[model samples]
Target: MRLPRFLLAGVLLAGSVLLLTELFAYRASGAVAFSIFTSVWLTLSIVNAGLGVFSAGYRPSEEAAALLPVFGLPAALAGVAWWAWPDGPTLPSPRLFWFLLAGLALWAAIALLAALLIPHATRETALRTAVAIFLPLWLALQVVNLLVGVLIENYSVAEELLILALNFVLTAAMPLAASRLAQRG
Candidate 1:
């Protein structure tokens, strides 16, 4: 299950696109909206990276394994470009930044755990299992952000739906894309 270079490139590109979308969505909305979104993007990016790493482990090559985190670094740089530069938007507190990183670490750990568990499970079931566990936890965090008033901006329902759709496409489609690429290679 080693992923081909093109497939890895696709996954990285797709993940970067999704992260940029979140950053743009936040910038479009306002501060409260940005705050709420901050953690969500980090969580998803971490999970995406986690999944990539987990999937890469299937083939166990030093080259592929080395590329795992590199795939995610672009998104991080993108975030820094969008959020952390001088003369960029200032926020209520820096605490949210730390929280987002923590969330990402947590999700990354979960992905590693899922990767470890998958070997004992059937191949047919592992991807489904990973998705099942990931989506719920992700949604729940978003809901909590809204409930806690972190997402204070007035977002249209359509906007929410669009974000959800973008997230779904990125997370759900990645494995299929990787699977196809792996098979072909």
Candidate 2:
């Protein structure tokens, strides 16, 4: 897929995920922290899916070219979120910024490695491989973030696990679904 199409898919999917979560989960729970967490998760998922889809059938160098926007979209969104977040006495804006930066850096490194390792694979294969590699790295980061108190408590362990599972499914499935549709057209 082309870069613009990849980016458009990422944004649309991210927006849809955010809207659905806000409507179904956030509204009922009424928890700001949970909403933020859900948004971040969905944004990152969009990045991962976009990276996989756009990098398929490309060499490492070409994949590298696609990496910036794939990573940048979520990072930019996160930055916006931080900027727009309500400033209260308890709000640690600087810390949140650094935390987000760190997460983005880690994700970029992992994604680059995955892309290079799976270079020039078939669309479905490349996306599946990327998703397999990314899911663990993402889950590990989430665990670390939770343990380090970067992610505030808003849901139970069971709920978090469910969300994680759903994330994995969506992240893996979306690219494959898009690729199939692209093939038929």
Candidate 3:
């Protein structure tokens, strides 16, 4: 999770944020919304990262390495939600709790699978590899998923946002657990 992984994560995050900015532009939220967004996101992400270094006893470099995926994924979900709906989404879609169930199940299954199957020496590398592979694919596939839901399924903004949130949780859980396992073992 150092040089190459850091570089890959950075590229992925920057590209996603750029796509988010574009999506915000596409929505009524405006380009100005993205400008304000990056400002707020940068400020919060930096402060949180700083807190991890100072209070949580995590290394600065590792915290920095983590910031992209930790924050960017949720933001990308929000962007897709915005693009899927004109007025934008509010918190907690009608079907949101179902995702909470599914996400937890996915987290457990993937973590268990990784623990059983992934080699101990390569857990970190495997985590990064999974993340690198999952990131782009998730975003691209979700775009199509959102479009289909919006156009034909007539999914509400809340429904779309909920799905995006579900996607975020499912994608993030394994990498998170793997990183922790790698750190400890």
Kindly provide the TM-score of model 1 when superposed on the true structure, using C-alpha atoms.
0.33
Model 2 lDDT-worst window of ten: 21-30
Please identify model 3 stretches exceeding 4 Å from their true place.
1-121
Which residue pairs in model 1 clash with each other?
none
| 2 against 3, candidate with superior lDDT | 3
What does candidate 3's lDDT look like per residue over 1-185, in tens digits?
Answer: 33233233333343344443333233454344434545655665676577668866889998898788655754564455456643433224433343333333333333333332344526665555555555565566556556756876798877876677676666566556766677687
**Model 2, runs deviating above 4 Å:** 5-75, 86-118, 138-185
Question: Over the full model, what C-alpha lDDT does candidate 1 score relative to the true structure?
Answer: 0.43
Q: Which prediction has the highest lDDT against the true structure?
A: 3
Across residues 40-88, which tens digit of lDDT does each residue of candidate 2 receive? 5455545555555665444556555666676567446544543453231
Query: Candidate 3 at residue 3, lDDT?
Result: 28
Q: What C-alpha lDDT values do all the predictions have?
A: 0.43, 0.46, 0.52
Q: Which RMSD does model 1 reach against the true structure?
A: 11.0
Ranking by lDDT: 3, 2, 1
CA shift of 113, model 1, Å: 1.4
